[model samples]
Target: MKEMTKKIAVLGAGSWGSILASVLVENGNQVMLWTNSEEQAKELNEKHTNEHYIHDYTYPKELITTLDLKEAVTGADFVLFAIPTKVIRPVAQQLLEVLKELSIKPILIHASKGLELGTHKRLSQVITEEIPEEYRSGMVVFSGPSHAEEVANKDITLITAASQNLDNARAVQKIFMNKYLRIYTNTDVIGVEVGGAFKNIIAIGAGILHGLKYGDDAKAALMTRGLAEISRLGVALGADPSTFMGLSGVGDLIVTCTSVHSRNWRCGNQLGEGKKLDDIIQNMGMVIEGINTCKAAYELGNQLNLTLPICHAMYNVLYNDADIQEEIEKLMTRPGKSEIEKYDEC
Candidate 1:
């Protein structure tokens, strides 16, 4: 049996981070749940609860929460980064300060999605740059059809653990899977990342449909076609086509797109309801990844010169103040073409 005495540092103490922390504690590992706020750390360390981010959820009494970066990651076998995508670079930069001082190298697992906007760098690329070169490959992405709320409630869910190394992928799979969570291992890091990474863009579009009071068939078609666009981009990025069909790909897209609890979906719905982009973001105190993804995907789409009509429409609506109804009408009148292209005829 694999050793279970590992110390795992989970950054971001959100619902997803808390759920995973609970699982690690259950697995006989020492868990350090890190937070940016000292107040949140107090609640988590003293009350065994994270009422702010994860409502009605109580962490294990033994689970440690700290504001100190060095303390949170000290001697841990793995560092789980569940921070928001936009904050990833800044947070990783801060971690470098701690790492440079103490010099500990543990496997860094990122559960965040959404590509970096200006850099157009994948999350993996960002992580590699953050960690030292010799330890660069010690990275993993925990991705799949995981909804944080459901995970906090101990719901049975599936996720894919991906790394460049097959052995490391299996190790990550074994570490993350619990009775309530099933973990699969994969080697297609880019495909797995992009599958979970890019689907938020489409999920926002799904929410827009709900706000528009569209029929279920309309939503389903959008999701299917949206997946096609994502697959196209992923292929161009050197991701395996088959990865788009796996748990992290279509599975995650379906759940994120359909669920009312999805922040991205909710953000899109609010936009579709005619709220201003700035207003929607201001009201949504939580991180809605789709908006960030929209910016990055739009910029990246232009960089790659790829045709992503759905993304383009959403970007225009979110950033350019384009009329949602008008954009939908425009998409409806788009030129006809095969849904499955020769490039990615899967």
Candidate 2:
């Protein structure tokens, strides 16, 4: 099939959104980057760089950015939400209102990776709830081990485009696939979403280990057990067990935990070094999804009656102000069991 040019509005002019906008523009799409901050939008349009988010990388000159919601979404072929998970609902609501005014129905793609705080709803769920059924062409989540800073520099990155609808997943795959960036499509939205959200928690723990001067042996053990914990909760919540092994699952988990580009890892590293959560967050000047994801996953695990010890340990450190070393000891001292407990019963 011949490639058709598209007009894509990428909401949230953060690092990820800006990277997506740049990629779409490179693919010959008319791209508009939307942000709430007029000053940031103006700076992007004029300077072709989002210095605050991704350092040392400049956006393509053709990439357009706007603060006007109506102008961004009007007649857009696809709307990609790359904003923080916490504000996903509000942004989706605003987009829905704009789409209603323009009478446009476009495919929705979200790259944000965190569950809602109280509701524990996936980012796609929040988008769908805010956007009326008729006005949305489809909703697909694009996730994996992608770090926006590296991706902006055209680093080799692989990501999954996941949705219940195969067509939507494939459509996203087409728009994003390039020589440097590979896109894989999957129908397991639940699994993909779970992997993307929960891995951040594990990454935080990984950072904590690094901060505490733990060795590779400790990191390896934590990652292995962490995957088990993630798979358990995900499978209990209707995700495919094998999805945890895919790019969005173990692949994402590995990268986020080890990379210096990861915000969650950086935050966790600080916490491990005895820094306060508030201080770490304030100094970082970026949204650390793991901080909130830890809380949401903890609540979700309790509700589902799943044992997520690693997640629990991280949650205790962040929310309860529990000692890091104590939580580590608690995790290390946990009773031993079969590695395949979930499947042995099956």
Candidate 3:
């Protein structure tokens, strides 16, 4: 697949989507960025800047933008869905309609991180549920610690390309890997997706700790314990426990929890500072994944009868209007248990 000119369709013009489109264009692919916002499409095409998303980053002049979903996806070699998780199923359903018209099957890749609200399905699961089998050749997940802001700036970054099919994962890696961007292949799709989605929940907790003025020691403890919590759930769901130690798991958790670029962390910081959830959402004007993920994880924990105290605490803060301090105290005061109780299980 080296030096092959492929037509790539990037769904969504959010920061992550725009950055990916730019990278594909840089790699000499024919790239089209699809956005529902007519204004954003115009800005991307004419101004070559997606200021609303990737701040101060100029898109490649060769990159195109279209408001028409069908036009963006028509005859694409690979279709990367980088939209919000809430709309992933709807987009996949719409893509099915487009595929019906074009009669084309392209490799499917998703960079979105979050579970579906009601169904709690992974993004790939949502795509599979909505899109017919004939319309997509393969599905892969592109995730890790890489942030859109840094990626757009051409900072050195590493990401995971995960699929049950190793060939598909490598194909994705071949297209995306360059000097500044590195890609690794993995077979554990469940662990990768689970880690990517669940880390946002822990990131919010990290931000809350930050806002509460908890020092580095407290933050370190949260991250470590958070990894344990994530690994337990991932293992329970049939993911390789070691995947939590990989790039998509602990790696992603570290970046999202500590960085200012993380929307989830920012939302949590606001919450810790005594802002209302509604106000935080309104002010950010972006999808803070952890808020919704918290709900899903809370429900899932209840269904699975798993003890996910940090997730439950965050859920209480967001949904139950519980005081953050009281919730933290509750978490801290929980009965002692072995540190690696679930470690051997994974």
Candidate lDDT values, in order: 0.85, 0.90, 0.90
Evaluation by TM-score, superior candidate among 1 and 2: 2
Q: On residues 234-265, what C-alpha lDDT tens digit does candidate 3 reach at each position?
A: 88888998898999999999999999999999
Instruction: Judge candidate 2 against the unseen true structure and give its global Cα lDDT, from 0 to 1.
Output: 0.90
lDDT tens digits, residue span 20-115, model 1: 888888878899988888888888888888776677877788898888889987887788888888888888888777776767777889898878
Q: What is the lDDT, from 0 to 100, of the residue 7 in candidate 2?
A: 88
Q: By summed lDDT, which 10 consecutive residues of candidate 3 come out lowest?
A: 337-346
Clashing pairs in 2: none
The C-alpha stretches of model 2 lying farther than 4 A from their native spots are 343-346
Query: Candidate 1 regions off by >4 Å?
Result: 135-137, 344-346
